[model samples]
Target: RKPKTLLAGVSGRARPGRVLAIMGPSGSGKTTLLNSLAAQMDKAPGLVLQGEVYVNGEICNQSMASMRKGYVRQEDTFYSQMTVRETLRFVARLKLSPEVPYEDKMAVVESLIKKFSLAKCADTIIG
Candidate 1:
């Protein structure tokens, strides 16, 4: 068995006040690259991920990146019993700062629903 190279010579910079979109066809390693950058990539036998990743001009490792960033996959794996709004509220509570008021947090969740046009299904169960 030989180790496969999922990514090689991949380099890019994401600067403040700008957007960096990773676009590609399916199975084009977009997820792999994001996982590596977010330090969420799992270590598997015979899988070698070698690269230097930096955040805000400093070298980023798992601990450092985990502290400063969050990653969400493109799939919805929320609790099937929870409604869309409920799921968003749950996530907002976990991710938002403690100083953020409950009302504000809920407001944030509402904004997300509207932003993504999920209001129609906001109260619908994920199931």
Candidate 2:
């Protein structure tokens, strides 16, 4: 069971500390590409993967540790009962280093909101 490689000869550079977006019309293989990049898909029958995927100059393999590169899908899932700040605090608690303080986490959250152009909608709670 392997995932298919959907793109070939695609090249682009995302500079460090820059925001990136993946935009396209419906059925444009955006999720497929993201799945392959994240290597987070569940095993399924009849899937065939070709070519290679490298993250931070390392090929994707079983031994690779949990990848930290942020890849947010278009329709992300979140709990309905949590406030925006609570949800973000939970996420930050899970992702940020243990030594990072609450203020640093809040700063990271604010920066991510600005980075994602989600400032205006940051306070909105998910339903």
Candidate 3:
């Protein structure tokens, strides 16, 4: 059985200080592409993924093993007792470079909250 191709001939680059989005209609492989790029795609029967993904110009396969990547699903899940800010902070600490200063990490978390308009419920717990 051959699994249908979710993505084909897709190539692009995401550089520092720039934001790139993978947008398309539903069932258009946006999530597949992101999972492949992050090397976090689930290994499913008959699902063959063949492509090259590069991060910072390094091949994903070669570097993903040692790299720390983050993937936020469309439906995010978090501890019901933790506030949004707390959840973000926890993820930032775990995913961000160890050398990144605490203040800088907090800054990034704050920026994300603002960018996503989560400020209104930043302190709300997930339920």
Best model per TM-score: 1
The per-model lDDT (C-alpha) reads 0.83, 0.71, 0.80
> Relative to the unseen true structure, what is the C-alpha lDDT of residue 39 in candidate 1, on a scale of 0 to 100?
62
| Clashing pairs counted in every model | 0, 0, 0
The lDDT of model 3 is 0.80
What's model 1's lDDT at 33?
89
In candidate 1, how many Å is residue 96 off? 18
Clashing pairs in 3: none
Ranking by lDDT: 1, 3, 2
lDDT of 1: 0.83
lDDT of 2 at 75: 70
Candidate 2 lDDT over 26-109, as tens digits, reads 877667667666674443344445677765676767666364578776676687777666678789988899999989998888
Tens digit per residue, CA lDDT, model 3, 29-103 = 887788677665673344567766666676666646557655677765687899999999999999999999999
Give RMSD to native, each candidate: 6.7, 7.4, 7.8
Runs in model 2 with CA error above 4 Å?
Answer: 1-5, 43-46, 56-58, 61-65, 79-127
